[model samples]
Target: EWQLALELLQRMPELGATADVISYNAAISACEKAGQWQMAVALLARMPKVGLNPNVISYNAAICACERGLQWESVLDLTRQMSAARVAMNTATHTAALMTFSSAGRWQEALSLGPGGSPRAADLGRSCGTLLMECEQRDLLAVEVSLTDRLSAAAREGRELPADLALVLDLSARLRRREQQPQELQGLFQALRRPRPQGGGRTWASLPYQRELQLLRHVLTEAPAGSAAAAAAAVDDFGAELGEAGSWAKFAGGSKAATLLAAVRGARLGDRVLEIGTYCGNSALRLAAALPGVRVTTLELDPLLVAIARSLLAFAGLAASVDVWTGPSKLLLPRLRPLRFSAIFVDRWGSQYDEDLALIQEHELLQQAGGVLVADNVLTTAAASFLWQVAHPPSNSFEGAFTSRMLAVREVAQSSEEDWMSVSVANFQADVFRQAPPIPPELLALQAASERLRERVIRSEAARLEKGAFTEHAKATLSGAGIAPLE
Candidate 1:
């Protein structure tokens, strides 16, 4: 169908009818739906040559194509081109661009765009929540406050807020309140609730992760401490509660937990172990409890989850054995100083597994000779690229042949869904770091442009804040002198 569409457009001139913008748009849309991103982009580029100016619909189709292909840089480029051509972007354009940026973890760029005119609540909430989480994780308090204020104003103007945004805002407010009252552990309960905008039928309390943290807190508070047996018992109790509440699928328990624990126990790890995902600290708790001597360093990108994991770890008496680092694995991996771990567990984004492994090797975070790398949810996450790379290691990337196995496990107890965990051991004869592939010239240019745009946004925000403060001060001074301030 896509081929026929493209052919029809190309033959328009031969058939004595010139291709118009609408014809080109139809071809691009066909290609986009068919997953032919390159063809779609080529058609878009050919528009100018054929004397047809690309409009919002043409650009949106191309952007959608690039987004579907995960061509984040392309999406950025298309949006920039739209701006240069003075094509006013609609909500669809903004939504596609925001999705691409969010998928690529470019939260700053996504936040810079903000909620465009007449945006869908679901799309806007997801983008805002992701950006806010990034800010929280990076300790960007100013940016977080600014974003929440913008969202609050939007809500006041009758914009609907989705459940995700409401949940994140509640958590953000609670965290701020908790920081003010460090001595009060129950500050979240006592903090004055903000008037929530009504739209989504869900509340923060109904969130599964929050419920999991609460259950863990209650169970650990009641259970005895100071030993691995007690911690394991607490985890079991927590799992049982989740099952009763029909939320066990969210937790990494049952067969998945058993397989991960088995991999760790069989790894013969040394004094250090690294975990990439620390959701509720379930796996970290299990690893610490299993090997009391091995110190565990876990990385979690979500600040809320990091706080919950830390709380659960402390309550389970394993806080001393595990250190939870709050940030994405990509940013945190390079910062881990000279501390090589004998075993590394990866349970984060499956698409980043290969890239993170390369980072681990480059930074020498994993012991070269006998390091064990265990990756969870490989099959379900469609991590075929990672599996193939580890199985067929390039000579330059790895020192020696690597041995690995894929173990299938049930995602949840008595559930039909199955997942796989890959456990691999290194057999390096010498220390070597895999050299990262060079970025394409086009991508480098796009990166430079994105950086410039980000700086411009920052400068614009500073000017706006400065102007607002000056206006407020002027009004106060005029009022004190018995003169009405200028409207």
Candidate 2:
């Protein structure tokens, strides 16, 4: 239908017909209906060049297109143009702008719109609910509670809250009261957290990993400030009081601490927060403390670690504030849609960082504007590939969407050994950043082939081990035969 409408407009030119503002508006609307945001923008831009003046409706159509594409910066830019052209702003204009802010996770800005254009309390509540439902800050929750109170009072007096806002607040209150879980919201949580099949589990941390995390946390806290040498020596002191550091993910080290602090400091109260690697819930605790009543969701790959993290969180009286789920983030992130995060702390295995980020884009998980991505251990060689992707995003895509900064720190337990690390903070900005291009067919085929080969290798090893030939000699024999051993 939209295509036919567009074609009709184009055919008008062949019939010696001139397009008025209505024709352009109709064409733009057609493009919007077809989800052709770029075409809609192009048509709007072409209007003036063709000697037609763009009215408020023209600007609204373009802004709506940008909003559909989640091109928040473009939406804001067109709105500014509308003001410069002296076009009177209307309810539709304000609604479109607010919706853009909401989609991009610019909640603070959304809430700060000027007078004569502010949304109703119920409308504001709906947006706030979207922004703050998963957020931990009490103040934000208090705001919602207050709004709900007002709405309830209004209802008692025969006035009613908007249905959308009422539903959101109801669900939020239920979740807070332990009457519900996010995973229960099938549409929201994406999938159920089922038990993964038991296989030869991979062990990531040894004593060294634990010690490194502990040492890093210790140095960050007790290390003498302003003295590099003292900081170095504190790295050497493994027996220092564990304090708060002892409770965090043992392997996060100092960079993660810095990243968490940076993220929490930059995050507004009640902003939804995500931690990629919970390990033992150390950073999760810190995040909760940093912003009281702030909701924190942490993902761990191992179910065993998930149990441990939950136990620790319970012991710390933080179980209610931090929701720890078991499963790889790549798999779980897709399920966390319609619940965009305000900040994401990446402390997962360094090698998986790139793939994890790709999943984020695939899922549209991050809040588009002012959202932060804080990654730990950016200095490690293993992290180089991930670092490159963020620092040098593909041309015209995610290139200017994030402004990144790298902070230098030391490896956790390997502090005395001078194992340095880095924290990368990438803030989402209101700029044009294209989505990641699709995976090439060749790469997909290669990945499939690799998976098949890996499965074959695992099967052969399982058969060999099942035959009771699990001795060192058998291992050496497999190695000599170029067979991969199971970890």
Candidate 3:
């Protein structure tokens, strides 16, 4: 088959058709699959002579061929060319490089790729297994012993290891050791067995987690499973029961409005979920009800609104599953533990989306693989910038970059012509091998200076508000002071 492909490719010029990069790429792919490493390299080298630049795909195929032939040097050389040519290395390229390093007993080089180097976690385990075998090879035993001793000493002193090395240490003991095996691997494994800190000392039980767990168990045990219709009926029954209790608040979007979110989220729940705005607890309840196993943390700026949400949640028997933090998200987000959220829903003020998005990125809050970020009411003028961001996010910003879609819907109770909401759902595609570069020093300095200025302004404004003299300012100046006019 590959021979036929190559013959066709060579005949392109004879057929009066110029061979382009795509044609070359297909030829390279055929060579790679057929284990024709020399042929693949030859074709790759010939591309530049034909006025065609080898892209990442071209490099990836060539690297895979080298990997199959145990040609680590060629793989490394191609990777360097990828950098020089400014080609973006995707997951396939990284995986191929790692496999080549593993096959050549270059365990240290493979370990430098980091835990996120592979797009799929399962593939990462297979790579680790290969690296482990290399480490155990008789020729590399001395280097392995020295590395294990150093890593174990570091672990005993409570020092953090590189992310890839940490993962390797965790998996070392799983492999069968050979005769006369060094004790270093055993020591490293034992050193990492101690329990680590959880949630940076913040309390979750104070939010009454046990009570929520019991309630969730009851709901799940009684609900019929096996189909989507059953789940929807359960949710509808729960919503009706809450409404009958007279605590249901009239919110902008209801069950119908949440259809897009439900469809994207699917049946299984994630470990951690974040809600940017908890208005009257309707959305929070819906999220908790749908994803019963999920841990939800909601942020609300208004104290009165927080209290109302708490009351409504308690009335709906969902107080245990959701935690309500009473403060501006900008202030609270920085204080929360550096835990990655598998899903984040934004229903807050649209103008603050950019600032909040920056904070999320700065803190590394999204899951390292793929996560979901959903925003509501995107049709509003205030949300224009936010919509533009999801629609056209920076390339390779997150592990798996975000791919977004906007769904149009009518307002919950208003006429379609009078009011509307657009829900934007973005699916993140994590490429673990793509590490974001360090932030520039000037950008860091600018952010620090802006933060200092904000603190001073906030102090001055708070003093004026406490003294009840804030209203004396000119109307034009009041707007800048963030003071709302009295009704």
lDDT of each residue in 336-411, candidate 2, tens digit only: 8867777788885444677788777667677675666777644332344454455433364445345555454554
- Residues 66-114, model 1: lDDT tens digits: 8788888898889889989989777667767776776676867776776
Q: Which stretches in model 2 have alpha-carbon errors above 4 Å?
A: 1-250, 253-255, 268-270, 393-398, 417-487
Best by lDDT: 1
Window of ten residues with lowest summed lDDT in model 3: 207-216
* 1 or 3, greater by lDDT: 1
Model 2 deviation from the true structure expressed as Cα RMSD, one decimal place: 18.7
> What is candidate 1's local distance difference test score?
0.65
Candidate 1: pairs in clash: none
lDDT of 3 by residue, 242-347 (tens): 4455322234344444653574374224577888877555667677776767888888754324434554454355666887664456546665557778777777
Q: Specify the highest-TM-score model's number.
A: 1
- Distance from true location, Cα of 392 in model 3, Å: 1.5
Ten-residue segment with the worst summed lDDT in candidate 1? Answer: 478-487
lDDT for each candidate structure:
0.65, 0.54, 0.53
* TM-score of each model, paired residue for residue: 0.57, 0.40, 0.37
Q: Write down the worst ten-residue block by lDDT for model 2.
A: 189-198
